[model samples]
Target: MIAGLFETHLKVADLKRSEHFYGEVLGLELAHRDETRPITFYWLGGRGEAMLGLWEEAPENIQRQHFAFRSTVPEVLRAPAWLRERGLTPRNFLNDGTDQPMVFAWTPAIAIYFTDPDGHSLEFIAMLGGGPRPELGVISLEEWQSKL
Candidate 1:
């Protein structure tokens, strides 16, 4: 039986840099480090909920990937400033110079996007309490709330 996403892996140009970003910056708990390989694992939600792996690789061999972390509405609302404080630029889905979270009307979820040091797209997302509103398309938090 399938439960949910257990783990995901990404190739990083520098393992130690990615480790500090995911572990120290994001506060993910360290799961393991393989001395035999240039790889490290960090627990996402907890020790067993989900895991993320970062493998060291040459810049030429690395490919950027996108992933999102589950979060609450309140947290997503505050994420822009928090990210800015850390020198990270929070962006909307369109990334058209807007640094506010946007709601995907189709999924009715709010999300803020950013990138890690290695330029891997990352997001913090939270599902909203409503039926789908695909017709509304993606809109800013203020617009979404005005409709509510």
Candidate 2:
């Protein structure tokens, strides 16, 4: 029987910088790290949930990755400004290179997008009420919530 997800490993150009971003800036707990061998692991929430390991490597060989963390409605709402204060630009999931957090009608989740130091697209999402998937375009969380 399937239990749950364990962790994910990602390659980063600089372990120290990535460590600071994932740890201090993002507020994830550093579960384990080894600067000598140059690999670091962090927990999404304390020692539970799941862990993420950042491995040092050359930038050219490191293909960017994307992932989303589950969050609550209030947290998702406050994320854009909070992330911006830390020097990260939050964008919409459209990858349009613009800062526009959105709400999807299909699965009904509020998602805020941003790129990490490694240029990996990341997202924070909160599940809301649902409906049939729209053909295209996303709406603001305020607009999505107001309709209900």
Candidate 3:
């Protein structure tokens, strides 16, 4: 069985600025940091369950990237409110896109999309049970297995 994700490294043009935004505003705990090397990694967790990760090393003025996190339906709905208090805009998946949110198509699950400080698409979605299954991204069982 697969375990949870470790960390995601992002290259930020301004490390200090990204650090402040993620550490101060988002309130993620700094697991390891090296200012002289200018690399910092934040881990979001209480004991051993780390669900959030961040890095600052992207090139200057690059388009935002997307990263998704897992949560329960309630957490998916409530987290945005907390994030909004810190000035982070939460775009309901059901209300976004030229057509509609793909999240809704995956029934028994719910998700709320939002952007990070750098405009990167971040989604907190509830996967009914836990974690994501390959079928969640496929139209048919054959389509899912064929890729592998």
Number of the top TM-score candidate: 1
> Relative to the unseen true structure, what is the C-alpha lDDT of residue 90 in candidate 2, on a scale of 0 to 100?
83
In candidate 2, which residue pairs get closer than 3 Å at backbone N, Cα or C atoms, i.e. clash? none
Indicate whether candidate 2 or candidate 3 has the larger TM-score: 2
Model 3: per-residue Cα lDDT over 1-148, one tens digit each: 7686766666566777777887898677777787667678777555356634445555664567787776666676577677778887776654443211234433435566776666777777665543445455523223333433
- Winner of 1 and 3 under TM-score: 1
Encode model 2's per-residue lDDT on 2-108: one tens digit a residue: 68777998899988899989989999988988757879999975588799999999988899898988798888878889999999898887768766668887777
Instruction: State residue 87's C-alpha deviation in candidate 1, in Å.
Output: 1.8
Q: Which candidate number maximizes lDDT?
A: 1
Candidate 1 local lDDT, residue 61 = 90
| Candidate 1 C-alpha lDDT tens digits along 1-148 | 9999999999999899889888877778999999999999998888799999999999999888999999999999999998888778899899899888899999999999999989999999999987888999999878887887
| lDDT to native, each model | 0.92, 0.84, 0.61
Query: TM per model?
Result: 0.95, 0.87, 0.66
lDDT ranking, high to low: 1, 2, 3
Q: Which portions of model 2 show Cα errors greater than 4 Å?
A: 95-98, 130-137
After superposition, the stretches of candidate 3 with alpha carbons farther than 4 Å from their true spots are: 51-55, 61-63, 94-107, 129-148
For candidate 1, what is the TM-score?
0.95
Backbone clash pairs for candidate 3 read 10-57, 11-57, 11-58, 12-56, 12-57, 12-58
